[model samples]
Target: MKEICIVEFTSNLGLKEPQTGKEPGVNRLPDWLWKHNLHKSINPKNIIRVDPPKYSNIKDPETNILNADSLVTYSREQAYLINNLLSANKFPFVLGGDCSILLGVAMALKQKGNYGLFYLDGHTDFMDISLSETGGVGGMAASIVTGNGHEKLTNILNLSPYIKEENLWCIGNREYDDEYENEIRKSSATYISLQELRKQGIANCTKKFLSEIQNKNLDGFWLHIDVDVLNDEIMPCVDSRTPDGLTYDEFNELTSYLFQSQKLSGLEITILDPDLDKTGEYTKDFVNNLTSTFNKHFNN
Candidate 1:
């Protein structure tokens, strides 16, 4: 039995206020994600909070630890905490301050040994410091895991490469810079688009993805889902929501199958911008989907 551990990281990362636009009074926004609400929504009463360490602000965007500190320490703490929890037969399900928090989950899981990574997001998040149009560290987590970004992050777990390129599969990515596109081609990673997902069907695509890994005798698989992959009409609480993304049922079905795969080692859910959520519709959907998936596959 895999014990589910939730890490609440409701950080006001970098002190950046929520962006303008978005309906008011929606619980989808970040302001209302209290532990109590999480308890009511997700099963398993044993949840932990991983608060980020304070960091100093710097003028240079790249040098700004205030925002980047969370990204670096996220995996460090996650790795330490989850290793112990997993030893006790628990599976860590990390909730986010942003997608950057995945760096920690990756680090934590790396301790179990090399495994495949299934990244579902709107953007590739493989941009390096030079390629990143936005200096947000969340956009660079993929690059970091692939050993392209900050040495601080890649060096985690003391492994030269935190994540092997062959073990990575990117899904639902629609936007990318020319450099990012080029990197994807050169790298050993595989990917399918949101349009491709809709055309081929999420289950078919996921099955295909699973086929590639089935031969590897994977120790486990990590699932990193960025809410931005959903169309803003349904999940408008993200900083970068796509126009043609998956529907709630579509996402739910996908997660249900994924959990049922029994290969899933851990999960990390990120980039839910509660600031933009209008009527808590996003929260309701998120809670329901999370609840349904756990009950169907993990409640035994």
Candidate 2:
């Protein structure tokens, strides 16, 4: 039996405004919306709600405590929990606060050395503090995992660098500029654009990605999916919305393919804002889609 654990990331400091043309500006997610409903959707039976320690200094207009540079602090506690669970071989299914929560997951899985990462997002999220055009720490998740950015996060989990560039791969990116793209090129990581997915088809892209992971002889890996990767038509409730993203069907195809690999040791879903998710439509769709895919892939 595969036991599952859910890590809730309820911080927005790392996240700034969603800059996509559809929704341009700094946007804060609603308070504890997903946290409340996740149990019913996933019904993990062993769900672990990880509320990261919040900082009291910033004037948070969003009501919820915005834990900023302090994410590394909460990540430490998360690492302990994840490490213990993984020791028993449980499948971790983490929920949003922001994409930055990846720091903790990366740390906890550090012992699975030479692990591969499949990062699915609309943005590269490779910006460093100095290069961050928006200064949103959430945009720097990839960088933090690759051993860049503030020492606090890169150094979290007591691992000098949680992941190596070669071990990382990014899929489905359509929102980034030359500067950030140049930085991404500097890393040994590989990536495919949304246009490429459309051109070649999701099945081909997914098969290629899985083949690459297999070729690497990776013992373990993590799947990080930012909700913004879905086109607004189907998933409009995300904190960030991109117009030219994957259709729900395309996303399902790719996710279903990858999940079947079972090389996926964990799954991270981030950036869903319940405040904007009226009628729980997006939540229900996301829950149903992912759960269905999980059921199909694992044949549960």
Candidate 3:
């Protein structure tokens, strides 16, 4: 059996300041989860921490994305660490600072071979710099990975477009602005809205994603989950709170099914801000649900 290896990277660099004008609290994720015994429950094969670059609110003048230089250097280091971990045949379960960390994961995969992505988030995260109001890399991460943004962020490690559009499946997106033109909708990547998910059923959606990616015959696929994808009522600790999202049961259904697929290479959970959830009630629940699911599926 493949052993689970945990990668903790609590970074807030991908986000913009909220009304507080201070750095968002996404950096506190790894600590918060561990306090709730998330790691204790999993008893992973090994645990490694990928330190993030210092937080900066100023957007990079060069890439027009916040922390551009730091993110590239950070991702390279992260890619090297994860690449080594995966090389040992351990399942790399990356716990993120934010969606921006996906670049490192993509780079690691690119070095090995072609890979697909299963992107689960409340927002599509595929906006261009022109449409982005805050210039946060987390907001436009989908676009960068698919080679949509500046060459600096997209062409890291001399590899442009870490993930092929047709091989990617962007799911559970409920946030969209009718005012701005939708780019992901027009792209080759598969886009599944929450409404569409309800109509089609979660099981069917999961099966379709796995089936389609398998047909592509890629090396494998990675799973990306931003905690905001859960319903706002139960998971309000996230950075960008929206009106509706997958319920805890729905979240379990989708993730458990996806994790069961043998092609699933790694998973990174992002965007849970401990600064928002001081009581730890929300954090405890999230940890319980997520760890239980992981143990149920893989630790069996």
Candidate 4:
């Protein structure tokens, strides 16, 4: 039986376009999820929440990344917390403030040894600071995790290139800026775009991805899901949105396959903006789908 630990990351400091004036409700996800009976479905006793981190408005002049200093500090702290949970043999369900939290998660996993990454998002997130218009760490998460971004953020915990390029597999990516697309083409990471995902079928494509990971003989792998990957009609509460993403059924199917693989060590859900979910419909749907799917696969 897998022991699950719910870790809430409430820092949006890495976002280039800071949510000012109004409430940045992404940080309140843990509360919203809990209020919506997420704990009841996933076992309330198993849930554990990490204290929210502080955010800063300062941006690094050289790197153009927002809150670079604070980001590094909080990332290490988040990593420490995650590492402790891993040591206790707990499967972490990290609810994120943004994709930048993947940096901290990667840092935690790197301490144990080489691990693969299953990046499931709408955007590739491989943009470097130079090309990134917002300078949000979230945009450069994949690049930072692979040791291809600014030195300070990429070298967190001295684990430069936290995860190897060859070990990373990106799926469900549909939004690719020109520079990001070029970078993806040059990257060693395995990428299966949403278009191709439809062509080959999610199951067959995932099977192939898992085979490659197994061939690499990795210790374990992390799953990163950015909510923007879901269809705009179904999930429209993210910081950024694009048309024609995966349907709820398709996403559920894909996550089910991943959880059943037994190689998944940790998971993070990012980019859901509660401020945009005024009717609470999106949040409710997300909680329902995620909790039901997670319970079906990991419930002991």
lDDT tens digits, residues 1-300, model 2?
Answer: 677766565655566545332331112232333434555656564766666564333423331223554675777777777778788888888776778778778888786566778899988888766675455567788877888755656776469578877778788888756776777777788867788778888888777777877898777788998888988777787666778788878888899888888677888888877667657777677777877777677524
Cα-based lDDT at residue 104, candidate 1: 69
Separate clash counts for every candidate: 8, 4, 1, 0
Return the top candidate by lDDT: 3
By lDDT, is 2 or 4 better?
4
**Could you estimate the TM-score for every candidate?**
0.86, 0.85, 0.97, 0.94
From the highest TM-score down, the ranking of the candidates is 3, 4, 1, 2
Runs in model 1 deviating more than 4 A are 11-38, 55-66, 176-179
User: What is the descending lDDT order?
Assistant: 3, 4, 2, 1
RMSD of 2: 4.9
Q: Rate the local accuracy (lDDT) of all candidates.
A: 0.68, 0.71, 0.86, 0.82
Report the Cα lDDT for residue 19, model 3. 66
- Candidate 2 has an lDDT of 0.71
What lDDT tens digits, residue by residue, belong to model 3 across residues 131-215? 8888889988888988888999999988878888787788888876663326887899888888889899999989988887788
What is the alpha-carbon lDDT for the whole of candidate 4? Answer: 0.82
- Report the lDDT tens digits of candidate 4 across residue range 139-186: 789888999977899998789888898888878888755656778778
Off by over 4 Å in 4: 18-23, 51-53
Q: What is the C-alpha local distance difference test score of candidate 1?
A: 0.68
Residue 91 of model 3, lDDT score: 87
